[model samples]
Target: MSKVLIAYFSASGVTKNLAEKIAKENDYDIFEIVPQEIYTPADLDWTDKNSRSTKEMNDKSFRPPIVESTDVSGYDTVVIGFPVWWYTAPSIINTFIESVDLSGKTINAFCTSGGSGIDKCVNDLAATYPDLNFAKGLRLTGAESSEKIKEWISE
Candidate 1:
């Protein structure tokens, strides 16, 4: 069996539940992309022009501070998960991919968003890790995504 890793970032536990379900279904190891500075509901208020998340999303180069890094060498497949931010994935995702040298690994991206899809995120990830193969991806609405994730995993 191929070794799989499910790594994700979730602020309100919506994405986390999805990640957990996929990991459990596939028997994949789980890794959480925890930020040094956690984002609360206040911090994620996109309506506020000056909100931290809004500002960070506006500045594409802003790197979210990661609490720790993990090695991906042992896993053949990595499912990178995150909540869509400002139509794109979180900057922390860039940080995660850069941290892991996924030279020849099979990377599958998954995401949870409000109403937007994961196309932007998938494209960005493909560009970022040109060497890795992006097999397939799943995107679920952040409201209640566990069942959707499980169905994707089964397929």
Candidate 2:
């Protein structure tokens, strides 16, 4: 059996729950991609144009600093989970991706969103890091079943 790593960044605990379920169901190691400066509830207020998330999302080149790095030496498969922010993965995901060498690893991207799908997020990641293998990305909710995650991983 190949070693799998479920690495995720959760802003509001939605993606965290999904990642935990996927990890427990697949018996995989899990890592949380925490930011150096933790986001406050006010920072996450999307409706306010002056909010941190809003400003960060507006800048395409901004890569938020991560608190720690996870060594990806032994993992062959990685599942990256996050919340959909402005129809894409948070800038922190870029920081995490660039921190690791995932050239030949199979990457499955997933996100928890209220109504958006994962197509744009996946495409953006693929364009940003051409060498990494990004498999089909999934849009999930907290209510998703382990069997569903298993099937998605298998795909």
Candidate 3:
């Protein structure tokens, strides 16, 4: 088993692609944070106020259900990846974080976004889960080189 784990939630496959690249480049284990109800394009429409994603993001306390639980016990570090929703991580990330015991693990965050940085999302998560050790956050655009990933992870 690898000491590092790359876990991510990808609604549009962008984040998933980046996560897979990171994991493969580093030879780390990977886990997908699947939602119980897969999101359709309509559900993801941010312009629609009543869309599933909009409604969920409107309620900060809402935690969209995940398909399955994950085991983080064996990994010393966990890299979480997600897309920026409402300028932060999707609520399913909250559900995933709560569902797993990440105590003592070095939690790093990465996100795929068209025009958002990873700082706010990482800060939000660190504030919410003060007990977890959140190390670094990177905003990826799916065009990163292997050396860039190695440099980020090494930091």
All candidates' lDDT scores? 0.81, 0.92, 0.93
Stretches of candidate 2 off by over 4 Å are: none
Residue-by-residue lDDT tens digits, candidate 1, 26-108: 56799999999999888999899999999888887888889998999998777888888887788888888878878887777
Counted clashes in each candidate structure: 0, 0, 0
Ranked by lDDT, the better of candidates 1 and 3 is 3
Where's the lowest-lDDT run of ten residues in candidate 2?
141-150
Between 1 and 3, whose TM-score is larger? 3
Whole-model alpha-carbon lDDT for candidate 1: 0.81
Could you tell me the lDDT of residue 1 within candidate 3? 36
Q: Which ten residues in a row have the lowest lDDT in candidate 3?
A: 146-155
Tell me the lDDT of model 2 at 101: 89
lDDT of 3 by residue, 25-108 (tens): 888999999999999999999999999999999999999999897889999888999999999999999999999999998898
Ranking by lDDT, best first?
A: 3, 2, 1
What's the best-to-worst order under TM-score? 2, 3, 1
Cα displacement (angstroms), candidate 3, residue 78, comes to 0.3
Q: Over 4 Å off in model 1, which ranges?
A: 141-155
lDDT of 2 by residue, 60-111 (tens): 8999999998999899888999999999999999999999989788999999
